[model samples]
Target: MTFTYTVSPKDWLGIAPIVVLVVMALVLMLVDLVLPHAGERSKHTGPANFTVLPAVGLLGVLGAMAAAVTLFFVDHPTSVFNNMLGADAGTLYADLIILAAGGLGILLSPAYLKRLKLVHQGEYYALLLLSMTGMLLMAGALSFLIVFVGLEMFSLALYILCSFIDKRQTSQESGMKYFLLSSFASAFLLYGIALIYAATGHTSFVDVQKFVVAQAHGHAPILLLVGLGLLTVGFAFKVSAVPFQAWTPDVYQGAPAPVTAFMSIGTKVAALLAFMRVFGFALSSVQSSWMPVVWAIAVLTVILGNLMALGQSNVKRLLAYSSIAHGGYLLIGVVVSGAAQQNHIGASAVLFYLTCYLFMNIGAFGVVSLLERIDNTGSDLSDLRGLWYRRPLLAGLLAFFLLSLAGFPPMAGFAAKYYLFYAALVGGHPELLIIGVVASVLGIYYYLRFIATMFMEGREGSHASSTHAAFERIPATPRPTRAPTGSLTRAASSTRGATAVAEKPASTKIAASPLPATAEIEPTHELEGWSWVALGIAALGTLVTGVILPFWLPQLQQAAQSLLK
Candidate 1:
């Protein structure tokens, strides 16, 4: 009936990433109020043109990363706030990834927010920082109480972000669904934690491990198994595993594109890290008991997630299913690491895969953002038709990202999957390996469909223009569409300049105004430089990081080993 607790300086070091993030978030939130607009930036100014919120956020995340590097030298694991959280290398690494995701989310947000005419940029960035802080806490929490707190903190921020576009009923529905389902999952997780505590007389992983070791003489306790199963289901929902993944497709499709991108990569990574921590470290002794259950879940996740994804018409929903399938792939690594006791390899592969997943997911969604600009609707597959002619660079990036998701060669996703499959092989799990391979093969269809719809196929007449009541209420009638033009040589070049102008009234059509030919040529030179830069960074990261795997893998391997220790 008693919980013994200890606090130490080492515990602070374990949560160093979070502490730095909190400080940064506060600073950014405050500074955003006074920051000047982007148009106000002068090239010869005394300060850089970076907005206050993004600048502070990036620096804070970098600081968190630096602290994580420092955490590597600290040896002992310590719990603080009466065993609320534990600080160790494993958690520090997870925090590092969480921080990186936050930084990227900030970078991708502003331009999109501006395009959509969303207000309260400061509040948005502040909430993002807070969410990152919560993820850092989730990665490090040692006890169930801390875990619940961390999960709520992250979940609340995300729910609000999802519904930020208040005018869109789909966005509101997405947030409400996530809020209700997530609350239900959290309650189960908490109840499971309580049950485990009742059976073992402890909530901390260390104490639970000791208690379980003490109870080794008896048959496996039913309460303990039930509790563990409940907890696993809770995590399965968070990571979008099969059966529990019902919310994913709707939520991803309805939410804003950037938020979907953030959730796809960031939320899954943090939850998986927590999942790995509990299953690989806390419950390692119960491997024989939980292994079969998780293995079945993994198989189902792979089969169902990929197979169902093939039928989706919406791009976001398709990627949602794709993420679930990828979760199954990562679960294979988790199973290998836990069952075979090669925790380091599994952990390393998970981290590497998560990093790779982020880049490609962001690239894919960035292309979605481009298409969404034209239609302002969800990213249906038809929206991507003729994308190659409209935006060649974005189309190519989307294809590359899709190929990566399909685990094609020379891409980071391929390398990440290879490491995972290798881990499964080394761990002697042939069944999981087979499931992974088969699922990946099935995944190729949807991924290729995306590419083909965007590039290879003819420009099909998609949705007719819908009425925009806020603007002129044009009747919902189909426009006379033209055949696909292979090149943008003549008519496209003439209309290119007017297309870049945002917020023009729908009634305004590009008529051939009597202008000098030389004047018509000038606007073509004024490119949308910022969008190109964003695309370039995303594409470059995807290509550069995977190509240098040899250099990065050693460092990741070292970090992974630290968690095992």
Candidate 2:
């Protein structure tokens, strides 16, 4: 017997965003093959000459976003490909967020890659789009098999992106660690899926849900409970929830800033949405079996994530922990959504908060990316000291993002949390609300400390006569040739020479006290044009999302209704 599979136009329409991204990635990869390397270009050409690949990538992301918006407007929730994937408001909303993150990441990469002499432009942009496709797939997946496919697709791409900085041992190490740990998580998730399939004789979420309801009315199997536990562990690891979060700080610190920013928001949005779908729908009848476990994880993640972040001096690591804490807050929505009565409130809160987080988190990391120097330097607290005096605009924008992350009033973060906690209270989960509130309060200290360090702290040694004393220590690079013997050049020469000589052996020590009065070190890295654009877009997004909450909230509510439907 011969079998034929019938495909419909609606199925293709359901996946238009993914199709667009994949095509763009392929085109970009091919185009990159023909593009000349930077070294082949004239020395006088600026980095803009190498921006074509990123530009194409940005266009692709924008195109995908447009497609997602169109799909949202269509407002049809359909499972395509034999119920393997869905096209619905929830998936489209996630697509918009993922595409935005991908765009911002692309915008941030050109300058960073150029500064660090990393020139695999084709691979970078292609992998970014490909990763985004995986996230989109995860957001739309309707079955366990599709989820696994999407998970591995993005995970593989991320492993490569994390290791893109070949010169940095830390980057390589991060890649290896993430790969090993994430593979283990994937295995657990897969085994859980397998166990669930064996228990229910189905991998489709709808069939699993039916089986779960039947089992709930009869006798539920212990194997199903075990599968649920394993699934929770897998998702917890992906979302960086407490005990599984040890890799977060190291990976975020070691990866390039743009990659960290993209991963922070993209992975959370994808994993959390999948988590919600799996538990809120497929396993809703058995929630009582897993509710307490999830509750404990959420509580621990919030408390420990905040406390650990307090002592961090590195901006990236601090944000990494902050992300964990945010995951805890999002978990409140997950718990509330699992209850059949409060699903809409919980789901809407999650979508809205993720929207808010996408902007504020990416904006904060954009500032960090702009300031980061070659070899992943310049993210330390000391680098941010007196930042307001140097780059007032950037400092203010960063402060806004930090305040938003801290859930300060009149910002998106505060609005998002208010809805989230209120939903918890309405859902009869007062403990989660209380814990989230207390954690937000404790989290305030670190965010404010960073702001204070930027605006209130003095330069390292401002009272000293030597410029070198006032500025933060510079990284070691080859010394410039001797300048003219004029007073101005004398100070500049002495500054460079001092830095160079300091790196020499003790036997080659130079006199430290005779430097000219004017000797001052300047910040080595300047914000490039693309970085400025990325920052401006991110800041605008944060401001608009916070300030215009009333206008868009209804749309989010509608999307949430569609999600429940």
Candidate 3:
């Protein structure tokens, strides 16, 4: 009694990553609240906080990432804390992806926060770290308590992040909408967990799986089955599966681009991890009951997500729908993982796809964020009319990312898609493979259309009139004026009426003297230093992932195999 300790250093080491992140978040917030601002500019974008907080936040992410990698090789059981949280290789893999997204988001944040004159730099980075921490907890959750705690923790942080731009009404709407919908989903998940515990007398995943295995197929209690169904709803909502994806486009479009750049990928990684655990392993014995439901949702999401993305003029909204479609692709792996004898292959595909997606998706969103910072014009198609002529490097980058997203050959996206679809065929789900391929083909149209818009120039005569008209919206001043978020959707409709009202003679007069290429638009090659670095790294990741497919596949396969145990 005198010498023994209840909580030892080894126990803390079990959750070393979470501890590092939580401590970092607390330190940043305390520094922000305690530090004094001596000047007007410092009050909003404090020199101290802005410069140091993001760097600190990035450091925290890297530290946690390193800790996760360490946990992978440590000579300890994967499950720690009485099997409440798992430091399994699968969870560690998901944590790395979440942290990668957060690091990139931090890199993209400085300019966005400064440009918007947002205060609370400490809270911003702190919340981001906390969110990443929660995602890690959720991914590694071994008990229902940890799952709900992790879910609520991340959800609360995201609500604040979503409405961080309080000056914009749309941000408020996005936050409120997400809060309502997500809470409802969480309730379903919690209720389901309770039912399962009541039916099986176990709240831990391993115990629950043991109970399920003991019960003969189709003989499981009704309450346990219902609980499983409810869990699916919660996970489905998180992944933005169809019929539950209404919040995605608006939230992605309304949230600060930096936040979207991270949330779009990180959230999926966490949700899918929990989903695979609960469905692919814990409840696999009863897979015959749930596979049909998941299969249907996956097909619907793939078809509808691409179809909805086809007409989106807003790049963020387009990417949001694109995200929903990718979710469907990820789900295919989940469904196939339930297919007997193909568990490892299907699960591994999901991990590899997520690794590829983290780079390509964030890079695409970063370019959009850059355009927003530069011109306050990324929210519309008109902003992209002659992007290639205006910013060749940026246009080229966007083109490469879009092609990767489109699954063009030799890009990571193609390799990712290839593995996920191939898993379906290996799992005896040829129908899912067929449906996914067809939907991917449909998605290529919109992606290529975006690339074409960016790479191809418009007619010279039209540039003087139409392009000049579009240019009028961009301010020449150093600090551009702010407008309500999502105003473009409304303005686009009004522009149709105004287009008819404009005099033909004024347009003809402008077209007579077409602007020369030299003076078309000032070059904006000089982006913020950190943003350029983030984009450069993302570009390298996008290309290198595809190029080094052979190298990483074994690691992912090894990670995926851990989930089955």
TM-score of each: 0.83, 0.89, 0.87
TM-score of 2: 0.89
Report the C-alpha displacement of residue 149, candidate 3, in angstroms: 0.7
Q: Extract clashing residue pairs from model 2.
A: none
lDDT of 1 by residue, 1-565 (tens): 7866566677677677888888888887767655555554232111222355556777888898898888777675655666667666666666766776676666666556544545566667778888887777777777777777888898999999888766567878999999999999998888888888878888887777777767844344888888888898888898888779999988887777767777787788777877876777677777788888888888999999999998988888888899899888888877876766644678878877887887877778767765554224536776566678766877888898889788887877888887788778877887777778888998999999989988876444322222122222221221323424532233345532332211322333332322222222222112234334555666777776677774677667665776733
- Which residue runs does candidate 2 get wrong by more than 4 Å? 1-4, 37-49, 75-77, 340-343, 463-527, 551-555
Least accurate 10 contiguous residues by lDDT in model 2: 500-509
* Clash pairs for candidate 1: none
- Local accuracy of candidate 3 as per-residue lDDT tens digits, 465-488: 464556434322212224356433
Every candidate's lDDT = 0.71, 0.81, 0.80
**If both were scored by TM-score, which would come out higher, candidate 2 or candidate 3?**
2
Model 1: CA > 4 A from native: 1-10, 34-50, 73-84, 217-219, 374-378, 461-534, 550-559
Measured by TM-score, the strongest candidate is: 2
* Cα-based lDDT at residue 243, candidate 1: 76
RMSD (Cα, Å) of model 3: 6.9
